[model samples]
Target chain A: MSSYHLDHLQHLESEAIHVMREVAGEFERPALLFSGGKDSICLLRLAEKAFRPAEIPMPFLNIETGHEFPELIDFRDRRAKQLGAKLIIRTVDDAIARGFATPKPGIVSRNQLQTPVLLGAIEEFKFDCCIGGARRDEEKARAKERFFSFRDSFGQWDPKNQRPEIWNLYNARLNQGENMRVFPLSNWTEMDVWEYIKKEQLEVPTIYFSHERDCFRRGGQWLPVPPAHTGATTPDPYAGARPTEKEPVKRLVVRVRTIADMISTGMIESKVHSFDDIITEISAARVTERGSRADDKASEAAMEDRKKAGYF
Target chain B: MSATISHSRPPVSHPVDILRFNTCGSVDDGKSTLIGRLLYDSKSLMEDQIEALERSADITGGGQINLANLTDGLRAEREQGITIDVAYRYFATPRRKFIIADTPGHVQYTRNMVTGASAANLSIVLIDARLGVIEQSRRHTCIASLLRIPHLVVAVNKMDLVDWSEERFIEICDQFNEFLPRLDIKDVKFIPMSALNGDNLVDPSVHTPWYVGPTLLGHLETVHIGSDYNLNGFRFPVQWVNRPNNPTDRQLHDFRGFSGQIAGGIVRVGQKVMALPGGQTSTVKEIWTLDGPLPEAFCPQSVTLVLEHDIDISRGNMIIGLDQLPGTGMDLHAQVCWMHQRPLQRGKKYFLKHTSNTVQAMVTEIDHRINMATLVPEPAPAELVLNDIGEIRIRTAKPLVYDGYATNRLTGSFILIEQGTNATVAAGMLLPSEQLVRPESGDYVI
Candidate 1:
């Protein structure tokens, strides 16, 4: 009948839920790479719709850069506990402490430092698959990413040699030490994520909504002022770089377009307070969501390079 | 003034459906420029993305700002000036959302084209107006027909170079009409446009006053895609068995439901259905979705169905409506697109994953490989190499319930997984079954 049609949001939801179920049916060990962002929040809801009533048959993994917004970290913990899912937090600080990473001078953001920590966790837990929330519309390199992106034993993505994914059938076959980075939201856009969140009434981190925060301008982008305490033992995420007098601190009403390390995530000035406002804002957005991500601005192929080095 | 007010609101103010399509053309055919023109003219390009394109030094062709750099994202692709992999681009109008699978067009990348065109509802085959119907155009059209894309648009690109000639466009259409009947495609439209100069892309061009038709964007926004799904025979390949068994919740404590995406037809509560391989019949007690319970479910909707009786249906079982039953047999004949470098031959075993079921299958015979150049069957090919399209027969260890690929793409399609590498070796389409009746032991529970 004519009423059998599913709206765009419903279609995207069904497609994502099918992908999540495929991982559950196929893999021996799979983990959802939770970042407490809107995309992963949508992923959690899709997972619930996929394998609910029965517990989600996978753990939640978070690679903390030690510079994460406290609100996001809190939300991540609460959501995982509410679902009764296991939350595994592997920090870049821990990787540095274990001598697996040496921090480069003047590089404040631990975004790139997250790769080794993530790879180490995969090796430690022997997770055959890690489901991520990466979308094709986010970045250039990510646009070409397959649903079941294969990584070598070294956790490297060889873009040119990606397996051809056809139909709804995916080739999830892998050898030992190798694993898959599954993106159920590969076809979803930023607007789609917000729309699904609105349709499903899924709660995201408070940082996603506009709020007053201490910030300063750098590289023509807003950066949050790390708290004074800023974790006593670990090195200050804002060590080498601090806002000078030329770049004065301003209390701007800002909200994050993408959730990453507080040090590298840029804040856009907006008055979006609800999902409706967020959807409206993203619809008219002239720049991409990743445009606010300071880490990707380092090099044109930064995401691709880090992805090849096993970054989620 | 009302139009201006409506424009301020987002295009998705109301419920809109999605359309997935791919653009196919060879090198120097302006495939990327065509995509760039569409995105640019449709106002889908972001401000920062355009700035990046302007800043990049890969500009070519008289400094008109190479729009292809927007899609050719990889470093090697930028250096080599070609698309190496499938890049998905999304854009939306007031009417519908679009998912463009920008596939590469080299002969060596036939597998990529097949992969991109698999889930596409329509395909745009770009033809160089100067060159007319080339080898890549025929190859792509043949692949689109093989993949069973519902619609095809032969975009006669670079009309500016040809002085906007209507005869040139008609000649290209005639060339395609010669081989189109051999293909399975039903709907085809010919558009004359210059993607480089933004002619007849989103808006109609003044130069083509003699030629009257809907612009490319107008056609994409209003294409009839509502009947694209198969809605005749009910087919549900169970993907997972949902049993919440929550002690706290009484409703979910004893719930035993079969969860899957409906592959075909419409299923309703209180309808009599049959399970395949064992041929047991049961009544549909309820249909559950994430939102709530529904009276009926149609093709492509994922839902959990509860049966009236306690049946032994698990993750690889098929639940079907009694009216139009699917084929049940262990021997299969199908067309396959071999993907791996290792050539396919007889006696090689594989893990055949059809629907949600996977069974051990062996190749019985290689019927013929379709020659793309001539669109003819080269009989009894010794082996099907990588990116080769061929017909083959297979014998599976267990019986599968399925339909013909022409009838239903979801239920009738399968992939062969190589054992050791776990590499997907082939994408298959099952042929129509001769026996459509019930199986030998028809134990009706009614």
Candidate 2:
């Protein structure tokens, strides 16, 4: 009888797989939101386990910020092509150029700029549902999110009035224009993701491993310095990214804990190169992964405010 | 009896199991505070989270940090100083991983409590030691029982307010036990503690010299939840059909499998199973999980099952063992917790979602609504409004395979989605289908 027990990782994995299969079965047009991050990398694996021996039913969608690491974009393309998945990359640069999004003054992050591009892609593809790698453990606002979160036609989340998800049954019904953002990994924490990646031997971007890189200190976080631009015709995207003269450029051996925009994501200085070392470091870590993310530090309710405004 | 032990190396740690439980109590009973203290004392709170709490504490001025802000993420919730919705919190000790469903305890939010407890193996009901047992306590306990939560912990919080008196704690325990026998829950524990002062949460408090049981965290870590799911009856609700039909890959060209999470019991390769409604029997050819092919699989593990013979089965169909068959019928009697602003009445139609299947269903009759205060049934209420739990009769467009709610939570539970709005209006738990009294004439007879 003891053999019947599934470990915590297995339990979380089973739940996530169940959710992915539900999306495949219920939705007429669904898309997987893959960002080339560890969480989304895990999402791809879950999708494989869910409908393998067959193609993943949904296409993959990505909202690419122009400031993203070149390595991440390359990895994203490679993973999609390897799986024979249809990768749809919508860009914030395109949205800004088309006047769909207006940039805020002094804000070079482009974090908020991705929301419009995502909504526009949904409209372009007429997707009824978008499965994301977002987990409740990621943010406080997410803690109250539903498994099958309903969004209005504008992709806005109404935090106060979420559907009561009872048992394992989810209500995925939608009117025209309204779509749902389904999160299969809602119960998983940062530790669960790392453990799963280890168990499945899933490949992640090389930036997660410890390496020496040119970096700068700003707002008490280590941000990687974007590679110096050659004489390309366009302006440097990394310019004014540091925001203040007090932030000094320095070379540091650091590794990114989370894969977001290169400008917004922060790295911790450690010698953690292997998965075991990473897991041990996380076990003794004192700060949440998002603590280093400057975007979340914009305000106490930054994530919640952004979530209500249709940001994933 | 000579044995040499290797003292140079540490033993490799086994994987940690998960425990899902919920906390429910009245607004001021310290539900969120208990959760905050548990996470903090368990060393689960990260540095950034503590900083965020401190920042929010300044805005919501009390000069003292309010631990509730740790969970009340929404601006409205922070301003109002109340938990309006269910928030899930995750923490882990080396021994186990825990998922805490922090639900609001306001009377109007009974629907939220029901939603939180729907999937929990255990429920913690917080009682204010100064106030003793109140109507809200009874209401929460009744709900935990109605939801069939296997374990209950009555944490008498704010013990410092009552000077940590053993007599006061015992008196509160006595009050809870007076109504405990009326409920269906089997395991119940009462503890005295203060969520504010971090007493009896992670570590046993020295103040409680009279109480000699495990601390709240100790009990949570060691509670028996391995047998929570029904293992005697094999039930699988097919969610999707896996097929490749790939031209390039030879082995996948003619593949077809039923995919779903096992709802009950265990299934093995070459086992005989029956599909509901059609009643066609088939032999299981293979059971494949993400890891690989498995000789056997049990409840709650998702797998793709290949049948030996081609059969007519699709989503919404249940694959089950030949014995301990579930009841099959169109008439379903259930207790539902109404959720929408619109009241639930007879003649209203809804999309009844049970397991993986959704079928058109109409309310045939409203039998009775349970009075939360007295734990008695009020016969034939006019209508079940929001947050009201009542017994109702339903007629589905097609037959549903189900067991009683007491028998299986996964198989017996359902949700009612409003047709036009597509809003989930009710959470329902099916009563024993065998108790459905059918009329011989079938002419709307009661």
Highest DockQ scorer = 1
The TM-score obtained by model 2 is: 0.96
lDDT of each: 0.87, 0.88
Q: Give the per-residue lDDT of model 1 (tens digit) for A236-255.
A: 55675567788889999999
lDDT of 2 by residue, A157-205 (tens): 9988899988999999999999999999999999889998998998899
> In model 1, where do residues sit more than 4 Å from their true spots?
A230-235, B1-12, B58-64, B248-251, B437-446
- The sequence of per-residue lDDT tens digits that candidate 1 reaches over residues B1-446 is 00011223244564489999999999889889888888888878887787777667434434346889889989889878899999999988878889999999998888888889999999999999999998789989988998899999999999988999989888899999999999999999999998887888989998999878999999999889999999999999888888878899898898898888899999999999887766778999999876788999998988889999888988788999988878767789999999888988689889998888888999999999998889899999999999889999999987778899999999889999888888888889999877674744553221
Model 2 per-residue lDDT tens digits across residues B1-446: 11112222222233478889999999899999899888877777877787777766666654467778888878889878899999999988778889999999999898899889899999999999999889999988988998999999999999999999999999999999999999899999888999988899988898999999989999999999988989978999999998888898787887889999999989999899987656778999999765789999999999999998899889999899866777668899999889989999689889999999999999999999989889899999999999888899999998888888899899999999999999899999999877322212232221
Residue A27 error, candidate 2, Å? 0.4
Backbone clashes in model 1, listed as residue pairs = A53-B244
